[model samples]
Target chain A: MQATLIYGAGDVRVENVPDPVLREPTDAIVRVLRACVCGSDLWPYKSRAATEEGERIGHEFLGVVEDAGSQVSGLRRGDVVVAPFVWSDNTCDFCREGLQTSCRHGGLWGANGVDGGQGEAVRVPQADGTLVKLPVEEDSELLPSLLTLSDVYPTGNHCAVTAGVGPGTTVTVIGDGAVGLMAVLSARRLGAERIILMGRHQGRTDLGRDFGATDVVAERGDEGVEHVRQLTGGDGTHAVLECVGTRQAIETAFAVARDGGTVSRVGAPQYDEVPMGFGEFFRNLTLTGGVAPARAYIEELLPAILDGTLEPGRVFDRTVSLEQVPDGYRAMNDRAALKVLIRP
Target chain B: MQATLIYGAGDVRVENVPDPVLREPTDAIVRVLRACVCGSDLWPYKSRAATEEGERIGHEFLGVVEDAGSQVSGLRRGDVVVAPFVWSDNTCDFCREGLQTSCRHGGLWGANGVDGGQGEAVRVPQADGTLVKLPVEEDSELLPSLLTLSDVYPTGNHCAVTAGVGPGTTVTVIGDGAVGLMAVLSARRLGAERIILMGRHQGRTDLGRDFGATDVVAERGDEGVEHVRQLTGGDGTHAVLECVGTRQAIETAFAVARDGGTVSRVGAPQYDEVPMGFGEFFRNLTLTGGVAPARAYIEELLPAILDGTLEPGRVFDRTVSLEQVPDGYRAMNDRAALKVLIRP
Candidate 1:
């Protein structure tokens, strides 16, 4: 089977790899139907997240179960499913609390020895918990929507829900990437009356508007916060979605939220020290949101996707064959594509 | 009138200062019946906070309403009241949301020309919001409790309540000052099953034990977290109360909370940065509480105090006249007192 691997920074390649087999009683082997590149993938591709000789890449996908281990319940051969990026037992205290991303018995998918989805086939551990069975069979048309259920859309939902974005809320979305765009949709679905999307590119901003952003602020730094505040009657937005993992984005989200509002940071922060000031503490602002447990949101969002009530897959600006994932990475890294779906 | 002024680090004196008079339509002049030195006061006394020459100190007090401005309503002369350290209109959006400390029309006491309660006669702005009427007249027996209502006790209550401490929750309390001891009581009042008090001295620990601390961990840093975890089935406490402002205290609080648990930090974080690691973020821990809106909790706890159901005032280990405030600051600064009450 063919899979994608990153030899080093900016060196993504598709090469032959072993077909996945169930190694544990809780595992299920899936024949990949569709997978996609995530914004987070750019981190390892751009940063020095040291890649060994040949490491499996990708964390988002929809697939058809080819085999199931003895202990795997609720999943079987020929079942179509949406796999959460992180695998959890779903019975741990953290998972039961809807914080499966922090599950004591769970770990990140595709990292370590666990196989990832950007391949021809993969073995999913804790199959009963990791796989959300699709009501419909694997079809070409529903691939994009099913693929999104793996990460971006659910992540966006987590950002909106965790930030307490609701009816009449004026939200400021920092970052115009796929997740940020999805957050706009999520906030809209959650009934945010006004959303200001902060981004510089025209294409992404237009998509943001389509996704329910009422306005766009193209500036950066203090100017961006001022723009958001001006649009929010100088009091700033009721909720802020900090989707970009950077000091500037976090600070901008903090500055653009009104006193007592929340900053939901879904971005995977890397730096040792966040540059947020203690002024946020005195202002009674709440900070939360990290590592979205996509599985927690899949059941709730499945109906909307199946019935055409939500079109989150509209974020896929480009699509390619699994062999061309390297090209997809370059296109996305260069801002040529919002999201790239790969057909296996 | 006499006021306590800090001329520099370790230099405090009780001297003659200008008598406070109502300066605004919403102001009220209070003849302070009781005031107290706070743990935060020792920050500047210990040369931790930036200080200027001859600045009046203290922000907590109970007093008799000596005079009221034209617009002051619901309050009359001779009425005994406990004033929240944060003066808010109590009608703004933030206030309505129970974050009066960040009220749009609110201002903090004891900073930049704001006359504080360390003086015999102190002027309180936004009197309608800051002053909580005491059912009883100003009596010596109620002095300690009423004085605590202004800051520490209510702050601790806010921390415990905000952290969702309840019958099954295991609460770990950081800091053993007046507020920390008060938090031990607050957690007990909220029905926390296990109250782990982390502190040093025998005096404060004994008080903590009396206040319902089920266990005491005298160690600091990682060892303290290990101690708490060991007591909590090796998963850390379900709730943590951080009442000390330093970075170390905040870090300890974070380290001692279980995954999916909350850390309610009423501590006035003075440091520029709180170093959080990947472990903290991935654990799904929630952090709430800061510059506690004591006004929000005062009404709920006031009756308990007046009826003698809650004895948070037991935290006051010493009392002195307003003229001896210098000695009070010195005693608290030298750790000779768990808390010091000043009678004006």
Candidate 2:
């Protein structure tokens, strides 16, 4: 089998790896059909130090089950399914509360000796709890959208939902990445009346507009804040869906959030400290959103995607085979592609 | 008229001042019957540099309407009322959303030239919006509790309520001051199944127990984290009501907050930065709460106080005349008084 590995900064490779086997009573071996590079993966790609061997990378995938341990229930060989970014025992208290990302018995892909999603095969633990069966065919055009259920789409939904976006909500989405565009779509789906998409890239912002952004501001920092404020009648929006985790992004989110508004950060935070001082505090704002519990949302968001009401797959501008995984990483890092899809 | 003024660190004085007059069409003059020194007051009390003229102090009080401006409505002379720490036009969007602290036209007492609550008379801006008429007598025995409706009690309720306290919820209160004790009481009133109060003072802890703290942990920092962990089956509580503004308090709040739990902070944050790094983000925690919109909660919480179903005023452990306010500040700052009541 072939898999993606990170050797060092900007170093990505596809190499032969041993086939995955069920290691736990609840584990299952999955032959991945679809996977993609995540915005978070860029962090390690930019700063990870060199290593002699390599580290498994990628956390989003859709695949067909090849084998399942004896204890695995409700799934069998050839079952098409989507694996959430994190594996969780859905029966845990946190999982039951719809926060599978915080499940006590949960673990992430590509770490702790687990298989990375950007590979030919993955060893999925807690199979019954972590994988959601897809109703689509193996080669259905819907596969791309269904694959998004594995991470990206759910993450975007998490940002809007956590920020309390709903009917008549006015929202500002910072970032023109795939996740940010998906958030624009999610916010609109959740009935946001107005959305301001912040990004300097015309191409990506144009796609964001197609995803339901009513306004686009090609500004950064203070200028971006002013543009959002102007778009929102000088009061700012009711919620800010922050898809960029840098300090400047967070600052802009806080700055453009209306008094009593919420700022939900889905971007993996790059900084350690948050500026939630007396000013933000006095305004009575709420700070929420974290690692999206994709597993919990797959069931709720599936109907729309299956019915052709949502087309989140539009985020993928380029596609590559397992062998070209390294090229996909480079294209994404160079900002030449919004998101790259990988077929293993 | 006489009012409390802070001339410098550890320097409080009762001095003659011009009588308050209605300055706005919506303004009303309130003759304060009861006022209290708050924990926040002690902050400036300890560090405020000496000034020749002195600054107005105090923000909690219950009073009788002395006079009303020509355009003021729904309030008449002699109507007993409680003034929230901040004055707000209840009709503002933020106020309508139950976050009156962020009301567009709101202003804090003792700032922006508004009369302080510790004064013999207060010229309340936005009278109808800032003062909630009390059904009790001018000198009712429940005056202490009724007075609390102005700030302390509503603030505690804001902490618990913002943390989503409800039937069978588990909660941790990270302070034992009047507000923290009130939080314990508010959590109980909201039907929390269990409440853990962190405080070292025996007297205050005992009062907290009476206020509904099922368990008390006196330890701070690492030991405190372990103590709370042991209390909640090593998972911490569902919600943490942060009533102390110090860094240690915020850290403890996050440390003891269960994964997917909420930490609502009502304390006026003394620091500028919040430590919400990857660890907390991955836990899917929600950080909320701010300076309480007490006016919005007054009507909802007033009934309990009036019916003897709740007694938050027991937090007031000492009583002093207007002239002894300086002593009251010292006693509270010295840890000799849990809270002080002032009669002008």
Candidate 3:
């Protein structure tokens, strides 16, 4: 089977790989239908995260169950499904608490000899627990939106929910990437009264406006906070969604949040430490957010996608075949595309 | 008039000072009846937080209204009252949101020319908004407990409340100092099912038990987390109260919390930065806390203190006169007493 692999920094290729087979009583072999390059993938693409020989890439996918192990329940062969970026035995106490990312028996894709999502087929452990079954056909027009349920959309929702972005809340989203745009959509869905999108690119900010951002601030750092505060009548927004994990992004989130407000971040943290003392401590702000529990939120967000009420798939501005996965990475890294969808 | 002053690190003295008088239309002259040394005060006492010429110290006090400015309402001369550690004009939006510590017109005690609470008389800015009047007599036996409402007790309650400690939740409190012990009491008051107090001192842990600690973990860091996990059936506690502002205390608080749990800290943050990446981000944990809005909680906690239902003042194991106030600081610094009460 053809699969995406990264040999080293900036080196992505599609090559033949061994086919997947069910290895556990609760496992299922899933034939990939769609996969995508993620903002996080760029981290490894530009660092030493990739190997000299080769390493399976990607952790987001929508697929069809090709085969199922005996212990798998409520799911069978040929069924369409979405697997969260990480696989977990949903019955664990942590998973039961809606924190599948911290599940005791869970592991990340492409790590510890596990199968990566950007492949022709992959063996999914705890099949019934990790995969959310979709009633729609495998090739439905809603595939892109449903694919988002595997990662980005749920991550954006996590940011909004953690920031307490609800009715009448004034929100500031600190990124113009696909996840940040999705956060605008999620905040709108959650009934936020005002949404501010902060980004440097005019194209992405335009898309953000179409996705429900009432205002856009193209400034960075102190100037960005000033713009947000100016738009908010001198008091900053009530909630801030930090979709960019850089130190400046985090600082902007904190600065633009009103006293007693919250800053929820879902960006993969890039810095080791964040200052929480001095003025930050006395403002009564709440810092809440981490990795999104996509498995926990997918079921809740599925109906919106199926009913056509949400069009998160618009985030995918470009598409590629399995052999062109490298081009997808370059397109996103060079800002030529927001997100790239790959057909297997 | 007399007041406590700190000229330098390890230097505390009781000396004659000018009497306080109403300075603003919204101010009031408060005759302080009781004042106490706080854990946060130790920070300046041990470091260079004090000025060489001497600065007024102490921010916890219960007092009687000695005089009121023309605009002061709802408070009359001779009325007994408790002033929050920080003074604020309650009409601001931040105060209306129950975050008086962040009120637009608020300022910390001993800062920006504001009179500190340790003096014989304090000129309280925003008097009508910052002081909570009491129905009890000026010399009531409840003075000690009522004084706690000025700071530590409310600060502890803030920690418990921010951590979401409530019915059926298991809580772990780091630090056995006055604030930490008060957190145990606060958790119990909030109906926490089990309270674990972490400290190495037998004397403090014993008081912690008396304050409703169901378990005591004498270990620190990784071992402390292990003890808490073992007690919670290897799942960790539902909430953590970080009453010590050290990196180790913050780390332990995060380490012992179950997935989706909260860590609320009220201790003055001693470190500039905290690591929130790596494993911490994926745990789905919420870190929420800062300086306590003591004024916001004073009204709610006053009844309990007045009725003897809450004896937070028991933390003050030693008492001293204005002339012996220096000894109070020495006793607390040397760990000879948990807290020190001073009468002027």
Error of 1 at A298 (Å): 1.2
lDDT of 2 at B98: 88
Provide DockQ values for all models, in the order shown.
Answer: 0.55, 0.88, 0.78
DockQ of structure 2: 0.88
Model 2 lDDT at residue A240: 96
Among these predictions, the greatest DockQ belongs to 2
Rank candidates, TM-score, best first. 2, 3, 1
Looking at model 2, residue A22 earns an lDDT score of: 76
**Cα-based lDDT at residue B326, candidate 3:** 83
Off by over 4 Å in 3: A49-52, B49-52
lDDT of 2 by residue, B287-316 (tens): 899999899899999998899988999999
What is the C-alpha lDDT profile of model 3 across B1-344, one tens digit per residue?
89988888899888888888777899999998999899888888899555667888889988899899999988999999998898999998888988998888988888778877787988999998999988889778999998889889999999999888889999999999999999999999999999999999899999999999999999998888998999998878889999999988888888898877888889888888777774677777788888999989887887888778888888989998888988888889999989999888
Structure candidate 3, residue pairs in collision = none
Candidate 2 on A222-334: residue-level lDDT in tens? 88888888777788999999998999999899999998889999999988988998998888888899989999999999999999999999999999999999899889999
What order do you get sorting by DockQ, best first?
2, 3, 1
TM-score of 3: 0.97
lDDT of 1 by residue, A74-147 (tens): 98789888899898989988788798887777888678799877989989989998899998877758779878
TM-score of chain A of each: 0.97, 0.99, 0.98
* CAPRI tier of model 1: medium
Comparing 2 with 3 on lDDT, the higher-scoring candidate is 2
Off by over 4 Å in 1: A48-52, B48-53
